[model samples]
Target chain A: MARFKLTIEYDGRPYVGWQRQDNGPTVQAVLEDAFAEFAHGEEITVFGSGRTDAGVHAKGQVAHVDLARPMTSDALQAALNHFLKVRETGISILKIEEVDAEFNARFSAKGRHYLYRIINRRGPLSFDRGLAWHVIRPLDAEAMNEAGQRLIGTHDFTTFRHVECQAKSPVKTLDYLRIERHGEEIHMLAGARSFLHHQIRSMIGTLELVGCGKWTADDVTAALEARDRAALGLNAPPDGLYFLRVDY
Target chain B: MARFKLTIEYDGRPYVGWQRQDNGPTVQAVLEDAFAEFAHGEEITVFGSGRTDAGVHAKGQVAHVDLARPMTSDALQAALNHFLKVRETGISILKIEEVDAEFNARFSAKGRHYLYRIINRRGPLSFDRGLAWHVIRPLDAEAMNEAGQRLIGTHDFTTFRHVECQAKSPVKTLDYLRIERHGEEIHMLAGARSFLHHQIRSMIGTLELVGCGKWTADDVTAALEARDRAALGLNAPPDGLYFLRVDY
Candidate 1:
C-alpha cells in the first residue's frame, strides 16, 4: 500500500476534535468517510499529525492515508475533494503528495507550529467572531513577548500541562515562542518537536497575565519552576488556536 | 431629543437586510429593540446610511437614532451593546457620538466606500466560506483595472443599475473604481456619493468578464453607452459585498 500525505484546512466549529469519537462529528470521521467513498465502499483510516480539540482551527494540518488503489496524487486529490464537498463539511484537502511508506504522519514530523490569535478591541467582531479571541482589555504585547522568552529552551512544563494530558513526561524543550501585534490582532506563535496536552494554551494563558501587567517575566519563571498544574495562571480557550504547520 | 450617530459592524448572514421588514429579522429591528430597552420602553427608530442586501457584511456601517432621554455617548453605547448582546444578535455598535439634529444617516453622507472580495483560486475556501466570491478561473487583475477606469467619472449608469431601482435619474458620478490584488484575494473598491441599486455588483460582474478575457475596456464603454439593463453582462452575488464606510 502507498501512503499519501495530505495537507488540510478546516474550520473547527461543529467538530468534536480531530479524533473519531461517539460523542459527535469529528474531522477524522469526516475525512475517513470521504476516503471510504473514494475507496469504493471500503473503510479507510486517516492518521493525523496530532489531535486538535473542538473549536481549534487549522491552516496547514497534516495527515496520511494508505490506499490499496494505485492512483496519481492529483487524481486522488480530485476524488477526495469531490467526495468531501458532497458531504458538505468545511474540511478541504488543500494538497496531497505520494510519500514513502515509512513517512508516518504522527511520528515522522520534525516539529509543529501553532498560532493563537487575539483581537484587542472592544467592538464586537463581525467577520472575525469565531476566528479570534476578543479581549476587551488592551493587552501589552511587548510585555507578553518578553515573558514568552522566558518559556523558551528546556524546562519542566508541569505548570503548563493539562491535568488530563496523556503525555508521559512534563519536561519538553520549546524551540521558540514569539508574540507580535498585527493590526488589531495579536499573534502568539510557538514551535516544538511535540507538546503535552494543551501545553501551548496553558503557556499562552500565563503569558497573558504578564501582558495585562498582572505578572512579570520572573513570575513566569517561577510558575514554570513550580512544576504543578495549580500554579498555572489560566488555560486559554480553544477558539483562537490554529495548527499552523507540521514540519517534515 | 438628542440625535446620536453610531458606528456599527455586523455579520449579515442572519439578517434580512439593514432595513426593518415584517418578512423576517433585520439589523434595524435588532438595534431598535435594544434601543427601546435603553429608552425605557419607548419605541426607537434607527436611520441607516442605506440598505445592504442580504449576506452583505459591514465593517463600518453608520446610523443615527434619536432618544428622548439624554445620556452620555459612553452610557448610550454601553447600554446598547448590553441589550444587543442579551438578544444574541451578531451586531455590534463600534462607536457613538452626539450629532446635530440635522445630521441624517441616509442623506447627509457625502460619499460611500465599498469593498468586494474575490478569492481567485481553485481550492475551496475553508475559513472564508460565505465571506468571499470564489472564482475558479484565473483572473487578469490589471485588465480588469483598465476596464474599471473606463467607468470612472460621470456617466448614465442605466446598464449597470438594477431594473427595480427607485432612483429618479440614471446619471450618477462615480468618483473612482479601482481593482487591486492582495494575496489570494482581489479587492474591488468603489467610491461614489451615491449609486443606483446593484450598480456596484453589476459593474464588478462586467469587469470580471473583462478580467477573464471575455470582454474588454471598449466593451464596458459600449455597455455604459447602451443605457439599457439588458446590456449588462452579469450581476455578481451579494456574498462578497461589504459596506466598508460612509463618508460624511
Candidate 2:
C-alpha cells in the first residue's frame, strides 16, 4: 500500500470535530467517503495531524491515508475534489503527495501554528460574526503580550490543560506566543511542537483576563505554577481559533 | 425629522438585492425593521446610495434614514446597532452622521469604489468559499491590467451597461480602473462617478476574458464603443463584488 499525504483546509463550523462521529458530519467522514470512491477495493482510513474541536477552522491542516490504488498523487487529488463537490462541504484537498510507507503525517510534523482572531469593536461585524471572537471592550495589547510571553517556552502547562485531557504529561514546549493589534483587531499567533488538550484555549482565556486588565503578567505565571484547572480564567470561545499550519 | 446617514457593512448572502422585495429578505427590510424598533413613532424609509444586487457584499455601503425622534448621530448609530442584534442579520452600522435636511443619500453627489476579488487557484478556500470567485487557470495579470486601462477614461459604457439599466445618460466618468495581483489573489478596483446597471459585473466579465488571453486590450475598447449589451462578456458572479467605499 502506498501512503498519500493530503494538505487539507476546512471551515470547522459544521463539523462536530475532525474525527468521525455518529453525532453529525465530520471532515474525516467526508474524506473517507471520497477516498472510498477512488480506492477500488480496500477501505481507507485517513489520519489527521490532530483533532480540532467543533467550530475551529483550518487553513493548512495535514492528513494522510493509505490506499490500494496505484494512482499518482495528482490523479488522486483530482478524483477526491470531484467527489467532494457533491456536498460543497467547504473542505478542500489542497495538495496530495506520494510518500514512503513509513511516513506518517502527524508523527512527521515538527511543529504546528495556530491563530486566534479577536474583533474588538462596539458593533459586531457580519462577515466576521462566527469567524472571530467579538470582544466589545478595548483590550490592552501590551498587557496581553506580556502575559502571553510568560506562557512561552517549556512548561508543565497543567494550569492551561483541560480536565479531560488524554495527554500522559502536561509538559510541552511553547516555542512562541505573541499577541498583536491591527486596527481594532487583536490576533494571537502561537506555535509549539504539540499541545495538550485545550491548552491554547485555556491560555487565551487567561491572557484575555490580562488583556481586559483583570489579571497581570505575574498572575498568569502564578496560574501556570498552580497546576490547577480552575486556576485558569474562562475558556475563551472557540470561534476565534484556527489551525493555521502544520509544519514538517 | 432628522436625516441620519449610515455607513454600513453587511453580508449580502441572505438579501434579495439592497431594495425591498416581496419575494425575499432585503438589506432595506432589515434596516427598516431595526429603525422601527429604535424609533417607535414613525415608519422609516432608508435611501441607499446604490442598489446592490443580491449576494453582493458591502464593506462601506451608504444609506440615509429619517426618523421623527431627535436623536444625535452617535445615539442613532448605537440604537440601530443595538436593535439590529436581535435578528443577527450580520449587518453593522459603521458610522452615522446627521445630514442636512436637503441631503439625499441616493441623489447626493458622489463616486463609488468597488472591488472584485478573484481567487486564482486550483483548490477552493475554506473561509472565503462563497466570498470570492475561484478561477483555477493561471491568469495573465499584466494583460488584464493592459485591458483594464482602456476603460479608465470618460466614455459611453452602454456596451458594459445592463439592458435593464434605468440611468438616463449612459455617459459616466470612469475615474480609475486597475487590476492588481497579490500573491494568489487578483483584485480589480474600479471607481466611477456613477455606474450603469450591472456595469461592474459586465466590466469584470470582459476583463476576465482579457486575463484568460481570449481578448486583447483593443478588443475591450471595441466592445466599449459597440454600445450593445451583447458586446460585453459574461456577467461575473456577485459573490466576488464588494462596495468598498463611497466618496462624496
User: Can you give the DockQ of every candidate in the order shown?
Assistant: 0.42, 0.51
Give every collision pair in model 1.
Answer: none
CAPRI verdict (incorrect, acceptable, medium, high) for model 1:
acceptable
Model 1 alpha-carbon drift over 4 Å, by segment: A72-75, A85-88, A153-155, A168-176, B86-88, B176-178
**Residue B173's lDDT in candidate 2:** 88
Give the C-alpha miss distance for residue B231 in model 1, angstroms.
3.5
As a TM-score, model 2 comes out at 0.90
The C-alpha lDDT values of all candidates are: 0.90, 0.86
- Residue-level lDDT of model 1, residues A1-248, one tens digit each, is 88999999898977989999999999999999999988888998999999999889998899999988899998888889888982268898878999999999999999999999998887777667777788888899999998899999999899999888898888899999999998778999999999999998898888888988899999999999999999998898888899999999
Interface RMSD of each: 3.0, 2.6
